[model samples]
Target chain A: MSGQLLVFVICGAFAVLGALGLLFFHKAVHAALSLALVMINLAAIYAALDAALLAMAQVIVYTGAILMLFLFVIMLVGIDRRESHRELIPGQGVVAILAGIGTLGLLVFAILGSFPAQAVGLEAANGGNVESLAALIFGSYVFAFEFISALMIIAPIGAMVLAQQARLTAKKTQRERAAARIEAYAQKGVHPGTLPNSGVTALQDSIAVPGLLPAGRISTSSVSQAMVDRDAVVNVHAVSLLTAQRFAELSGEVPPAIIKPEPVDLVDTKDERELLK
Target chain B: MNPEMVALLAAVLFVLGAVGVLIRRNALVIFMCVELMLNSANLLLVSFAYAHGSLDGQVAAFFVMVVAAAEVVVGLSIIVSVYRSRRTTSVDAPDLLKL
Candidate 1:
């Protein structure tokens, strides 16, 4: 029954009660304000515990960055307030009630288990200062510290991408993707020079189509079949014209001509022998 | 546990605040819960200060107040801005929440 123990009991009660009130409250602003109360009280609690540096950080970092971020977001989103606009998830109330009860149980168990044990004063030992904690955090938790930096980078970028301003670029990207698909197909040598209204060419392709022809299109199908039958006449004409032009260029003999593409050697990074093994 | 009471209590308050944030749909409420958790730990530190009979705790607590005041100023302004963007004040309706 020490004076400090008594102080802890009183402050702890206030904190627990404040937290519960914050949870049960309906209005968000009120909750935030109450949470502020919790912050101040916590600082006081830390001061009582002889850890001055930690107390300040609690107020500065926790009260500063985290809460401000919350408020900023709250103001930005502008949710509908009318009861009609409330989109309550199914079983939410049930879950909330269960959570509240479970929280109460845990607090009670902790208090009971902790009862009668005299909470001693650790004034003799150093309550790891900023320097010591920073040493450990930077040394042992270097990865985690770096990870937080990465998170900071990623979170804002992610937020910006979803924002309304970015919607313009998003639409542009979609258009680019569609155009890319069309370009990719065209690059694969699919009738790049053909006119848009090349009905005869399309009809010719239909004859080679492997699937069923549509019903009531017997006339078109017959026309395509006739074109296929006239294939020898078309081929002979085209081949004769090409050969005549070549013969003229060669002055009748058409001396042997050859065109070759140079071979290219590319550097490979993989270990070929290891891969073979 | 006694020497670590502030740490333990700070941890508790912080956790409770987190729970408040998770359970409550109201943005303001969650924010307040977070502030509460911060202060709860602050109180533990103050108690430690008194226990150690040192003025460092007092100095830290003073700085914490300054930070808290600054936080309120900045936080409230941000909230005002957010309110303008979004008409409602519920956490569930945050624009970034949709999966």
Candidate 2:
């Protein structure tokens, strides 16, 4: 075996070990670091083959961008410092172990199986590397590419909405909870420490959108407007206001602005959550 | 080693990468796994490009890396926001749809 073979063997070993480490490791940061090692090794493998394009890509995307994001998230969430993360999920630890074993088994089976035989047969069909793949990805897989774009657009919106569902509920409940907490404390006539919790931040964001929810909780702050795209702003804010108002109505406290006794054509399929007077 | 052996090793890395991303529990780890997987794919493409005496695979790899970089920027922010909201790095915890 030559130096090149030795390099390949070493890098390949790191990639496999890193992959195993990624699976078995409990600490997220450690796993992330292991993944980075695997990526670097893969790049080295690319370099050994004289594939400069792939080598650079391996560095920039895997090392520079993606792994960095994982670290950033870990940092932002304070995962390393929190005690809550230490608490094992109900059945997760056992299940994760089982799943890991199952996954390893499946991968081993799949790889050692007949796929390579079929892959070799298909090699003749490939027109070339970058050009052909690009044509196919951008052409035949255009829908998939667009789907990815759509995912990029919709994921944040979905995540924000989902994460804030409880916060949204708490806004109304907060009104009640605040009244109760305040009244309980107020009877003692000592003002309860009025410092709001994280719930307030959600409400503040929701409110910043103009007319965007059950009670128009969204404010038309320029900063918020600047954050979202112009095309989506109107639609997002519109839906938000409708939903917010509907939620407020469920709380039986209709804001007077929309409570006017006019049979306005507002109660349509569009406002699915609106309650009739 | 010959190019074929290097190609084989690169393929091995690619396969490991896929396994890492698909199986990991922690979001950070999962993201790392994704990186590993992408890099592995890059290696496979690069090795094939060289063995076939073509530059196209390398070029395609460059574009893939560019897009991957963009993905990381957005993906990280999303994960960060999720961590802030849920206070957990476990991907299982983000299943807000069930709730």
Candidate 3:
């Protein structure tokens, strides 16, 4: 076998394996990494085919930029491993297998019917891979090329607009947030210690407070604070129930008073208070 | 390498991508499978260009790559936005259009 053939077989095997890995990996991060592997191997195949410019572009655009973007989104969204495994659409797996086989059979039949068996290797165009691509893009397909550029620009802007939180949920300014925090403290008859010169509050306080300040005997904020302080071992099941109740309250739904565990002593230690200071 | 063998490889890869797209529930994974299918098509185009002794195939492949990049930007943004609202990446979760 020629060197090119050997490389093709190896890269082709890698591509198939990577694609399979991408499909089956349980974690989104792992799947993203597998896709990157497949893309890099595909770039290698492009190079083997003497499409140098395409190979470089594939590496830079697909593997480098696009795959990285995928990883960023996966990380930003927080990887949730407990995804529902139930098929949302009934019989999707069986249909997919059948469709795959049908597509393969159709492609093979078409190739056999019309593809010429003997053909020459690609000729070097007017200049080379990059130059010829530029010529064709600029000369013959310039309008389409310009349209794609416009599309590229519009896509990011649209994505930003789509991904942005609704105007109602727009983040409050530091002063507004501080004021809200102070108001929450006042309602609870607790003195919010000296306000920080800067806007952001302590991490513990922020985590302890729910977005909606609820006045109640069993507060989710107190539970979370106890969890943080390691003062109480709140039952995991109970914590989840409390969280659901809190969510309901935040959504303006009537929250049911579930099992209220004995309130753990708040860690209002002098040392801890000083630490907050 | 025999052009026929290369073409066969591309066809198989394309099939795998199609199967993946059909089977995977994760929107991001499905998008990646679409990219795989696009890559396979690019491979076939380059192979045919080589066989025909023409540059047009490679040029076409280049255009496909560019379009794929643009598609990724738009598609991923939409996916991210959907995830932001629903907190789930499962393609089947969003059934706004389900009759």
Per-candidate DockQ vs. reference: 0.14, 0.21, 0.55
- Isolated chain A: TM-score per model? 0.47, 0.44, 0.60
Q: Give lDDT per model, in order.
A: 0.51, 0.58, 0.73
Where model 3 places Cα greater than 4 Å from the true spot, the runs are A123-127, A168-277, B97-99
lDDT of 2 by residue, A1-277 (tens): 8666788888888878887787777767777788788888878877666554456667876777677767767766654432223423476555655665665466455544332321222134345434555775576667766766776677556645544444422345667877887897868875466532211222344422334234433323322422342222333334435765776778888655543222233334433222211
Estimate TM-scores for all models.
0.45, 0.51, 0.70
lDDT of 1 at A183: 89
Provide candidate 3's TM-score on chain A.
Answer: 0.60
lDDT of 1 by residue, A118-193 (tens): 4444444455556544554566666755665565566555444444232222445767866776786788844333
Docking class of 1: incorrect
Q: How many residue pairs collide in each prediction? A: 47, 21, 0
lDDT of 3 by residue, A174-195 (tens): 8997788789798986556652
Off by over 4 Å in 2: A81-277, B2-23
Query: What is the two-chain DockQ of model 2?
Result: 0.21
Q: Indicate the docking level reached by candidate 3.
A: medium
